[model samples]
Target: MKRFIKSRGGMTGFVLLAFLILIGLAGPLLVPFRDAGRHWHDIEYWQDSPAAVPPVWVRGPWNAGKLARSGRLQGKDPVLFESEGGGGRAVWRFMLSKEAKPMRLDLILVIGGEGKRPVLVSSVGDDGAETEVARRLFEVSVGQPARLALSLDGARALTVTEYLLPGETARDSPSIVLVGQVSGLLGTDVSKRDIFTGIVLGLRWALLLGVAVSFLTVMTGIVLGISAACWGGWVDTALNRIYEFFALMPILPFLIVLSAVYKPSLWAFAGLALLFFWTKAFKPVYSMALQIREEGYIEAGKSIGAGKMRRAFVYVLPALLPYGFAVMALSVPGIIMYEAGISMLGLGDGTVVTWGQMLHDALVQGAVINRLWWWILPPGLMIALTGITFALLGRGFERVWSPDRGSRPTGAGPSRSGT
Candidate 1:
């Protein structure tokens, strides 16, 4: 542990990995869009946000001070006025600066009771000029809340612009949820989904997938490799053949084809990865087992009537554990990349949010062409950072366990030695 921390690369990787894990654990609680994973693809859920907006922190001369910040009026803030017709009307008023008029405005109306309810949404400017943005009679059912989302985009854009001039205070009936040109921590995607929340939620899935797959693959290899060494001749030869076949197999293309055919879920991808990746740890573990078999302790154990299974498990497996830990760490990055690659090709589970899926969305949505940097960059950077973190930790483990540079595990030495 001390040695690993002393190595600069290892320490850096540890810190980075720790930070990512922290985000994976704590991000959902911190982010405002707690339901982002569930409603990421739901257009109605994200209708309150401006589409393809940059982050709130982004500001420069290139944008010409036209970027408007988002604001919301909800709950008890909107004043409700009871009409003579046994219905109530609510109004929310907010000021828009002359320097930046909101690119988009949304009114969310939640109401209950049966029959059709007439929802009138209007934009009133300082000059008392009023423009009806939306007039819809929505069907409502008792015990079920009906929500109406009225937006300034599309047909109402011209009406809003002509009626609500810049620098004027505007009033919206029902409630005004102003979605501006700049929004959230990492802005909005083409679908207007909060990018930061999506990224944060994705971190948990990525880590879970990578760690689970790597551990399974390495453990499978260790068991098989040790078994082959314990019972040599036919057993060893057969396992060798199997390992060779898998090692030479074109995994990526095979996975792509399989994914295309089956449309497997994330867990299914992990299972498939394990089938191919076990071969990675096999050769090294087999060689190590062979060396450990020739050691004096093994000969002594055999002489004492200790069975092959007992000796293999009790003696050999323990010695290989440190090496296995290193191999497991190294294998994680590959597994993550494999999953990400499959996801990037649009073969991933659409129901779930992942870094690769984000990239795939960006490609399909023409984010690059539209110059939506926030959408493309965050997920890509996360994948790269995760890869680097595991790679560095793997190298550090190697340095600490290498035969030439590092000490061997206690009790692994020749049994004849007194020390």
Candidate 2:
């Protein structure tokens, strides 16, 4: 732990991972007040629509007139355009404080050519397309905040706020200036309950089930492996070879064959993984068991008239435990990777919300390449962190159990008291 804290990268990674897991676990609870969930979705939308929305100052030095002069302002450049269009989009930069600022953009809307009011006066894109709806001219006020509905079906309604304020700029990104109020830029419908609660609940179930299945399957393999190794001759030879044969068989073909015969479920995938994963642990554990069975302790147990099962369990299995755990530790990351790969291939249960399934969904939804950073990044990061955590924890435990590792007392090396 001390070494990890001292190492910058290790400390950083560990801290980041700890916080990420905590957030994944407790996000739904803390979301109402902290409002990080809004930030997550807002960041996602900001990045997605313009690819990467720069802060107000990051827009570089450009006057309002310069945007029109540049001829680069049209839908040709994503930074300036609200959406994919042929014409230029109007953008604005606004300040929230002396140091804090928001960026804004004006989207031009063309109302019917009856000298009527403009359809859209918000942010305009290069395509010259703006959302428009029928307006009732019961009252006309220039600087009043009002709720208006756009005629475009499914289009999110916009609140016209701060429409008259000039956009300002600081180090932060742009903000949208409404007609009367200085509110935030238009955002998505993502609520605190929407993104986090589902994700948190989904991930908790997935990871918990994943760990349980892995532990059970791996432990079962260890037991079978030990049996194969200790009871050599026919028992060892036949079973080990049989397991090896199964391990060598193609997984995809097997999944197809198996899923075809029965309905797909999380259990089915876990079972399939166990079948193959157990095979992987067999060889190493069998080797350890073979070695352990020949040790002096086993012979002593035999000389003392210990029964086969008793001697094996008390003496041989205990000796093999260290090696068994070491091998198991190393195989965990591989197991997770393999499971994810199989899930990605669509062999696993579609309803199960494992990290693997998440990746598969991202791919299917086109979010992987769609620049929806939050959607893809969160799942990918989760998979990576989970693998790393298991690997590091396993390594730490292995070293702790190692004869030559763990703590060494001061001046404790090689005592010569007998001399």
Candidate 3:
């Protein structure tokens, strides 16, 4: 732990990976404010906002022309445009600290998320009576925010509000400017699916697939490899042929076909991976087992009439465990990549929310073209981070087991090679 922390990359990776592991174990509880039961699958029911909403907190700079409730304004950009249920009036209050020259300002009404909803824009006086400033009806597109030109002269105090012309209260959320408690922090997908929650839940699937596949594949390899090498003759020859045959098969196509044929689930993919992944661990385990066969302890056990099971598993397996563990650690990334690849390719179970599935949805939804960057970036970053974490852990262990590695203590030796 000390040595790992001493290495900056390793420490960063460890912290990130640890958080993700906790996310997997705790499920959606990490984001306590979010609805735990509502996931990517349940997105359709609770998609209150328009699809492909950008993060609420991170909008472009609101310029001088945009009405201000409160906050600094920068380069010309859209201010948050929102209306209450029944398309009620939304007031944006602006204050003037000093006498200012009158300047013409254009306030464009950008409608987004759901579709064209006629908005009634008007200025308000101190008495709370609505003034007919700009009461023109304009059609707006879904997921596109368009502003109507409302040029207002400079004033000490200005109250600008929008009202929805009497119409059906939009059941679906407004397409743009959705950033609040009910909406997710990271915003919604193209389907108005909560990307934050999807990411949270996807952690579970990622950790499950990675660890389950690695441990199972390694364990299965150990059993088969040791058994074949110990029994020798026909058993060894047959198992070797099977291993070589699988090595030559097209894994991606096979998995794609498998997903197409069977009901896709986490366990189903895990089981399928068992066929291919074990061989990677199998060869090394068998080599170690064969080497162990010549040891005096094994011969002594045989001379004492020890059973093959006891000799192969009880004695020989334990000796190969360290090497087996290294192989297992190295193999984790491949399993994760495979699962993610399949998920990205649309070969994943629709109900399941994995990192790859998120990417798949984003691509299909044209998130990149729309510049909804939040949807595309996070999952890819997370996948890379997870891989880095495991790689650090695997390398740390490999150093621990290296023959020339000194035991002087972590961060101790100037020249570890000599020691």
Candidate 4:
């Protein structure tokens, strides 16, 4: 651990990994998101919110950035969507822009005089469907942003009656004001799924996969490799054959088939990933274990009546610890890549929320085409950064493990005395 921190490469990897782990542990508790896995229920909170709301901090003050509803405006107020006379029916068509998203429609009109008992507020969709947005008879403040929940449900127009009240005068109908949502620091996707929340939840899945698959493959491979090496002859031949066979296995296709056949699960995909790379640790571990097996320590253990299990595990395994650590660290990036690749391909479980799926949505939704780089870049950058962490760690561990290299692990003594 001291050596790891001292080395620049190792330190770089360790910091990157540690920060991601912290987020994985604490992100869920901090973010305000109802569902990270599926976003269908998110509509209840946002109710047809405008899609792709940019992060506020970066949206400099302009016509685009203005969302205030406090004081009266000099010219026509955009938020106050429509206003006209009262007495007859009037249809205010809000033509949907190409960049339009799910939006909750809101109506706010100040009735000057007295009006009829009933005034209707309805949202009309492009398909000519009518859904009631609101129905009110109460008086509204002369000017204010009402704190009321409304749903446009993808409507393209809002139609209201221009009804006149008694006490004298002209038609004074309700004016429309569309209150768009400015989500969190990161805003939302087309589906109104919060991107920040997705990133937060994804930290857990990514870390779980990177660590689990790394440890599982190295430990399993080392055990099998040492067994083959220590107990040679038929055992060595058979293990080598098995390793070679599995090494040649068409891993991706097999996983794709299984994903189709069974339900997609994180653990299940992890298991398949284990199969794909477990053999990677075997050959190197076997070579080193064989050298250690012929050492004086092995003879000493054997003369003292240490059983094969005790000899291999208690006496021999310690010599291979450095190799194990290096293999584990290096193998992590591949495992994460494999899991994310399959997921991005839509072979992963639909219910799981992963970075790969986030990227997949970006691609499918033409986020790149629309220049919504935020939707696509984050997940890709994370994947690359994670791979870099493992790569650096692997290099550092490799240097420490080499016989003639820097500080070595315990039991990695010189060939003469240590043997």
Candidate 2: which stretches are off by over 4 Å?
Answer: 1-199, 260-262, 401-419
Kindly report which residue stretches of model 1 are placed more than 4 angstroms away from their true locations once superposed.
60-64, 75-92, 95-174, 403-411, 415-419
User: What is the lDDT ranking, best to worst?
Assistant: 1, 4, 3, 2
- lDDT per residue for candidate 2 within 1-419, as digits (tens), equals 44434445444545654765676677567533243333433443222122211112222244332221100111111124333333333333222111112223222221121121222223222333444333333222343223242222222222221111123211111222222111112111112112233355445544555566667666777788777766667987889788879888987678767876777777777777777767766776666667666665566667898877876577666655655555555565565666666667676665555566656665776654655455556556666776776566555545534436543211112223322
- Please tell me which predicted candidate would have the highest TM-score against the true structure: 1
Task: Please identify model 3 stretches exceeding 4 Å from their true place.
Answer: 1-14, 32-39, 60-184, 405-419
**What C-alpha lDDT values do all the predictions have?**
0.77, 0.48, 0.65, 0.68
Ranking by TM-score: 1, 4, 3, 2
The ten-residue window of minimal lDDT in model 3 covers 67-76
For residues 61-168, write the lDDT of model 4, one tens digit per residue. 454323311111111212322334523333333442222443443433333324243455666665678887677665435443223344555666655543343332
Q: Which of the two, 1 or 3, has more lDDT?
A: 1
**TM-score result, candidate 3:** 0.67
Give the deviation of candidate 2 from the true structure as CA RMSD.
13.4
Each prediction's RMSD over C-alphas, in Å, is 6.2, 13.4, 10.2, 10.3
lDDT of 1 by residue, 88-135 (tens): 554444443344333444445554446655555556553556677666
Per the 3 Å backbone cut-off, how many clashing residue pairs does candidate 4 have? 7
> In model 4, where is the ten-residue run with the lowest total lDDT?
68-77
